[model samples]
Target: MTPFTIETNQYLTQETQGFYHTDFGGVNLPNNPNYLYKLKNDPHHNWSDDWIRQSQEQLYRVLLIDLPEVQNHIGKNPLTICVVPRAKADNTYNPNQLLFKAGVRNAIITLGNSFIDGTNYIQRHTNTKTTHLRQPIDGYNNDGSNPYVGITNATCNISNNVVGKDVLLIDDIYTRTVNIDEDAIQALISKGAKSVSFYAIGKTVFNH
Candidate 1:
């Protein structure tokens, strides 16, 4: 996929890309694209708030189509999306919370910790049962003390999520961080995800 392209849906194919036909019938890019595209310039007090509130409903619409895939892999929706927000940001976006009403039939979980006191995106999406893998308190991280707490908690959370079943992890952007995300996936596999694949909504205008 190109850098700007997003994962609209898993089942989509060449015939389906520009085609508009499904159980729901007819899918078009400009006319209800698989997912909404929200740039930083979009409205909102904060970037996290803007993305969570805007992308949830639309994103879930596509995510539900993959329910079979999710069940095949983890057996449910409301599956945890390990959203890693822009660095130096607070409360990264979490898709699980937003996909609840759209048809997520399970609990949601947050991977990384949120700033401003656990400002989780789960609340913004599904009110269904969920959990947060607390980013360990390793002193104020503002001065670049260490960012491992969040990733560490993520590893632990992914490792423990496998209760004799597979799981899915979500994230927003993936590039150089693929290695880092791979690390998280490794941890998830260690915990019990039959497989770990990502549904990246958007790519960076700038990739490090």
Candidate 2:
């Protein structure tokens, strides 16, 4: 599969780089029922749990094949993989809520020593507004004022193990508006990570 480079901005930092596997057209949009979208939202669409599992299994296969492409960009040795936490707090998630991270966990297990499994290296302890739900409130604007503003240190815990380590932060999808991936990048760096690179299974492509 071909990879796309994530564009950097003021908040994202030029020093850190990001990559993603495919383009996503979002849930309500037609012509793009991409794998990551389905895995993330099948339950809301009334699809069976089996469908969710199949989507996750499919992503597991892709991660095994495509993550190495992202690895090629990480100049550091022995990188640890950290996943961006979901909307709900970690302990509050059900099996459905756990799908994305589960896929990452499985991929790390198969990848062996090249990638360290630090999926839970950053843990969300507070619930945040789910971005896809499209609520009227803007999560990005009032960031410091509210815990639900987005993925920020106010709602998450970064592991001490990240100190002096090269981290590859992974997310199911990367959307510019919400900037969840960017926030995760900031959280990791603020925790003293030596370097941080990002990877998303899919990136939102509006015009596509």
Task: Please name the candidate that would achieve the greatest TM-score relative to the true structure.
Answer: 2
The 0-to-1 C-alpha lDDT of every candidate, in the order given, reads 0.33, 0.74
- Per residue, candidate 2 scores C-alpha lDDT tens digits across 42-114 of 3445667677768887889889987887787666668899999877678865767677888898898898888
How many angstroms is residue 18 displaced in model 1 relative to the true structure, after the best TM-score fit?
22
What's the TM-score of every candidate structure? 0.40, 0.82
| Model 2 regions more than 4 Å off | 1-10, 13-15, 27-33, 41-43, 135-151
Worst 10 residues of 1 by lDDT: 12-21
RMSD of each: 12.9, 4.4
